[model samples]
Target chain A: MFEAEVLSGGFSNPAQDSARAFRACLDAMARPGRIQQIAGAVPPAPLSPAAGAILLTLADATTPIFIAKSHDTEAVRRWIAFHCSAPVVAASDADFAIGTWDALQPVSQFAIGTAEYPDRSATLIVECEDISAPTATLSGPGIETTQTAYLPNLDAFVANSAQFPLGFDCYFTAGNQLSALPRSTKVEAL
Target chain B: MTDQAYNFAYLDEATKRMIRRALLKGLAIPGYQVPFASREMPMPYGWGTGGVQVTAACLTPEDTLKVIDQGADDTTNAVSIRKFFERTAQVQTSETTAEATVIQTRHRIPEVALTEGQILVYQVPIPEPLRFLEPRESETRRMHALEEYGLMHVKLYEDIARHGAIATSYAYPVKVEGRYVMDPSPIPKFDNPKLGGNAAIQLFGAGREQRIYALPPYTDVVSLDFEDHPFDPSKADHACDLCGSEVSYLDEVITDDKGSRIFVCSDTSYCTTRQDEGHTGRLSPEGEAA
Candidate 1:
């Protein structure tokens, strides 16, 4: 049953791929702003290596995920459902959402968490074509000194960070490359 | 070889390592609450998941384990917790205090004095001493960094002013060493005095709050009280019906429908041991079974 669910599609060996993806999650969370490339699963079209890696890493029955796009096809849904059993919900009610930034509409709809519990915020896994070094400089608890990421938009991230420990954390996935921006990070536009 | 079917002690090794590292830091600091990324267990919050996690990390094959809830070994929660570790870690279980190397408890410390080589793990529902005062984590983090604990002091003073005695009954707050004012779980103030100057190491875990704190062997733990008001670990001024012990903490039991109260020792094992030796209070009828 585990093989039929986790190994059916493109990933011939699900357990090994899941382990690699989990390592990427640990690295992303531990280092805050550091980008780690994660590749293994050969999921169908829209679901790239980085996106597939994330689904394997964080998605489980406990986590609520949302997929928002016409491109969110049945093959992608079947693979995730069989492997993780993660319930799919609307964008506003998701703990983690996957899609283009535009389809995820009004990022404020997701949970920013309460004043008492900031860690309750949602984590967005946005699919991108390529991730490069943006002009914005980043520094926080996890960073050794300072680093930069080419973000989809500086204004959205700057506004998000202003809330401090009360905003959504994001993971930008392009092909097998993934980078993160925790709420604690300070993003300054150049 | 590890049982590939289950993770180490039923927790992933990475998670155990993270908790183990946090435990070491907590021990070294002595009373400071270290923040950890606590995981969700099959059990509900407000239960003893925190204590379970700590026990899981510290358990070795050679260690004999004991678990208690409200000081009773046979309590349902305690029994369930013991069974979980037994199945996962395959460690030996014990009811005797002296024979056990690790004891996990909720709401009360054991009556038997723990010596060196023993570890007492407290199941904490909430580990923050200042959580009620400041609701926000951002504010509490700053408060801890600055050592601004006047709010806690003011709260205690107000309790005396209103009730003519400190109103806090269990889970009393205490200062560890000289740095961190820690919550001693929900054990009534009566057990507060036993916290400090003990030969055993004490650990506190609050899973929902994602916190782990400790008090090393012989560390100073002062119960929060004013100079004039003073702290008192007060209990019902009655002796145990089965054990004749007056100093042990008591659990108030209602014997009759009219609300007649009988004070019994909270430590069930200790009481049973004493009863076996023919100890009985004046209230217990002669030749009555324990």
Candidate 2:
């Protein structure tokens, strides 16, 4: 059993909040490395505000989500179940995953989608300590010139970029700040 | 119509979320079409149900929307879509391209350069650039996966072989970010260059085909062309007879029974704006200054 407090604090206005949260997520994803602020949901511990808001906005009954061990608390699970109504599943079978960079290790295990339908790939919501680290150089679509960000690592993302149209996309969140790193982005250590 | 009956924008929240997810994924992978479970809008598929759905998902109460067909806001289809949004979303509508936050377009991009906050949603009949050469979906999927664009190159080469120049004029294919080959809808090749490095976000929806793709703000989009025979974006070398705009795309209109014709700017708003600024052309009223 979980505390009632953990399950109760979802978006006050589901429709409007979700819409606003989604637009924030969309903006961040479209312009990779650009940070955007998002709010609405205050999920349980270990789940950042941005991550929780994203989960509430994007995850639903249809999407199977995988919660990493660091964030796999009863409170987090209860919050997710109550708000998103999404079934928690294994990373391999998940359409979305939530955790920190370390907890989501072996990212290769997640679905990168198939040739016929690359949209089947997984989207990960990674909780980070800071989004403004400014440690890597990013360039590609959405970027007119190279931009910098504080990525968890360079090698893994570069490897992921090499996969091209067949790699999982990622969102990095810290508190209410969010930024995305789509597979299309070219990441290099600064 | 009572607001209680249907959800905002006429789409259920679940459907919007689904489309939103697909849209995010599409933006993540520029120019690559992401398959979506398109819903049955009140309109038919070919008549921009896809663009409608995409617009519905993106619209907020504060957004000012513009709908256009062949770059004209007064066209039948454009009027219909504008009315649909005004009725359902209860949002302000604009005929001027500069004022719109979200512009849903069929066939052509607006002549005015888009700024940072605007979003362009395209109504696409066919989203696959390789559909003509290879009919099989499975084969085309593999081709996209393997980056096998030999067929497209050969087709362009054959066009040059047949006609001294590349013959494709509309629905010109572009490679986005040097990865996926994307179909920039049926916009004339003249607009293909506009697809790249634009400040506004570009979204493409193909309802009948159940596909959605995107080009994020400032994305790199290069038209497919050979080195020697570079892609040439050429339009009829004629200025609008009414607006006198030389750079805008012109539509040929028959003026008389004796085969007399005049060219007018396809972008009605751009033409009207120019005219309001006191610009007159050969076809303007006799009293107006040239």
Candidate 3:
């Protein structure tokens, strides 16, 4: 249902907010392991500001999204429907997915895209309690040298990097803070 | 007059977001072409519609833009693109390479080294380096997935066998971060070395192909070649007649009916900058007068 309260959390100024949010997302992704602050959307419960802003900026009618069970509240659903018009779908079919690292577990379920069209892969928006852990060293494209970040799991990312051009990218969100780990990044324990 | 009907930068917010998302993915997986929903622009496909679309998505009112074709600012295609953005995006335009925050280019990297915080959007006619060697997209995709670049090696080997050297010149192939083999647009092989360890972010867009890819700052971009053969970044071997610069790429110009020729710097800004610094070549206007 497109209730007023649920939609109120959407961007107040869609054009400018989305542009700014997308830039922040671009900056974070361009410089892997670097964290950026994003603001614009005030999503319903369980979604942090970074996650909300990303959803608003990237999701649309054409993009099917998957919301993990922990954050798949009725209000969140309504909010997404009213604001982004994105269809909620299974993880395998989603262009984007959102949830805690544990809730969105078995990352293998999400589409990593085919070799011919790897860009079709899903981008997972992971909610974290804190992103300042400095748990792993990240090295690869976007990183000048090695950079460190608080990733949820290093082994999973190492495996993902092994997949190379066929892995889903991830964005970790903690409140307004955001960071990304593209499949290209090489992850190692700190 | 600019068309006011279109949204800022000529693309709707949703489309820009979609493009931005693809660009990020492209950056993450350096040299891997990420498929995107390419839009129809006012210009033709080969004329840099792809680069134009990418530029439109990345631009803001605060940004200073530059567009070049064959490294010349006055080239017809470059002029048209610069005009399009000036009218539609209402952004400042610059012929000075160093002054631009975002540069959309076709077929050449600037002679002036790009710095941090700048973005280079390349207009690519073909995004796949394997497209020519293996005509089938399906087959090339498999080869890439399997890390089977043997066919490419063979192709280069064949060139070496026939020509006693690698003959392929423009649009030379590069391996990104030692992973995916990428086409660095149609820039001369001379520009290939500049692709690696650059301070600026380089993004490639192929509108007709509907793909986008990127090379982030300081990423490894090795030109594809065998150890025995070795990749050579060769140019015209002539100094620019206008700037007297031997290190820059030179464009050959026919000056007379008798078939006399002169070489000028392909990069106009670089030539002008050198001239401003009192550097003059044999064919310079002042030099000719003297």
Candidate 4:
């Protein structure tokens, strides 16, 4: 064990902290475009607190994670290996992927899942420099009337909506703040 | 303080992780039933094991849990589940519908309107809307994938042909987000309208079926019906005899062997609150003896 690198950043109390983190994630996902704050992880550089916390809460041996080129570093891999035993795989085969908006390039590379099993699609954990303000309109399940959030790429999400019931779900993380955009959301330019 | 005899919420950390992942996928899918590794509970399968496990997964130490059975908080299933969490999870349990963060229900959503922050966990006996029509799981799965809900429409049409109306009073099926036709557990058709555009997240779990599904807040949930027939949310015409509340779902209760009966609000908590506010019906104090 790289005791200092691995053990220092994870949840201090696995049970309680993970529970709290999960609820935050659930609320964020259920109510797309709503920003939330998740605590209890101080992972190595390139991984935000919310992203690290999510990996601890959701990733396990069964999930194949993809670390995008921007955040792919020796320290990040070590932290991931120590905290989550998930196998790292290519973007297309990943159950979950982590990186900034651009680093996760050719977003089409990820699985959009099959018609028979749409839930099998990948969930991208996006690391953002800033995730504030609302720029585009979003209406769908979870959203009351219509919500507005600043998505890095509006056309990508609009295209994603066309694949409704099929596209990949995403979580945008900046520092400790998190927000989500599921496939069900109807994204539009404001 | 709570006893440390069991893990927090009575589930190991790994199990919670698996459930959490499934819940996220379910939310993302919106009314699509996601399969999970359902765990055994101390209670029987019918006794809300699904709802209990869901609550356990969703709960935090800060949450206030409430359990309801057929709209009443005092029923055996409700009491047992509430006590189980109170003992094992050491979380605060509330009887008031407004104060509860997580409400686990066997049947019947509370009469009170839920807000955005609240969550409702439904104990579902059958997670599949087409389970009865198509006995084969594989075919039903394919049908769901292909969005072929003709069988359900046919089933409803047959009901209209026989009973002059769609006779499904309970376990009403609803289409979520115009995508998936979902089973809203065993809630009466009267509560079907409330399922759509709700402020709270609705989670349905079937431990026996090993499935979990969800509807995010304000999701479109349309009860299956024909244009001419229309989905009706009818209830007993009588008001609650004790509380004088005519809007709530009523249960017909027999008074004695003389075949005397009276109607009361199925939601005991709501009825009590109404009564406390001095709302009274035909069976108020002076008129009760008659």
Top lDDT hit: 4
Query: Any runs in candidate 2 off by more than 4 Å, and if so which?
Result: A1-3, B286-290
Put down candidate 1 lDDT per residue, B28-92, tens digits, no spaces: 34565777888888689887889888887777666789999999999889998888888877778
- Each model's TM-score? 0.60, 0.96, 0.94, 0.97
What docking class should model 4 receive?
high
lDDT of 3 by residue, B36-112 (tens): 89998988779998898889888877789999999999989999999998888788999999999999999999998
Question: Which is superior by TM-score, 2 or 4?
Answer: 4
lDDT of 4 by residue, B30-110 (tens): 999898999999998998888888999999999999999998999889999999999888899998899999999988999
> What is the interface RMSD, in angstroms, for predicted model 4?
0.7
The lDDT of each candidate is 0.75, 0.90, 0.88, 0.92
List candidate 4 stretches off by more than 4 Å.
A1-3, B286-290
The window of 10 residues in a row where model 1 chain B has the poorest summed lDDT is: B21-30
DockQ of each: 0.02, 0.73, 0.61, 0.90
Q: By descending TM-score, how would the candidates be arranged?
A: 4, 2, 3, 1
DockQ of 2: 0.73
True contacts kept of each: 0.00, 0.74, 0.65, 0.92
Candidate 2, residues B58-166: lDDT per residue as tens digits? Answer: 9887889999999899988999999888888888999999999999999899999999889999999999999999999989988998889999999999999999899
Candidate closer to the true structure by TM-score (higher is better), 1 or 3: 3
DockQ score, prediction 4 = 0.90
Ranking by DockQ: 4, 2, 3, 1
lDDT for residue B265 in candidate 1, whole number 0-100: 91
For candidate 2, give the docking quality class from DockQ: medium
lDDT per residue (tens digit) for residues A81-187 in model 3: 88889999999999999999999999999999887677778999999999987999998887788999989988899999998878999999999999998898999
Point out the higher-scoring one by DockQ: 3 or 4. 4
TM-score of chain B of each: 0.95, 0.98, 0.97, 0.97
- Model 3 residue runs over 4 Å out of place are B288-290
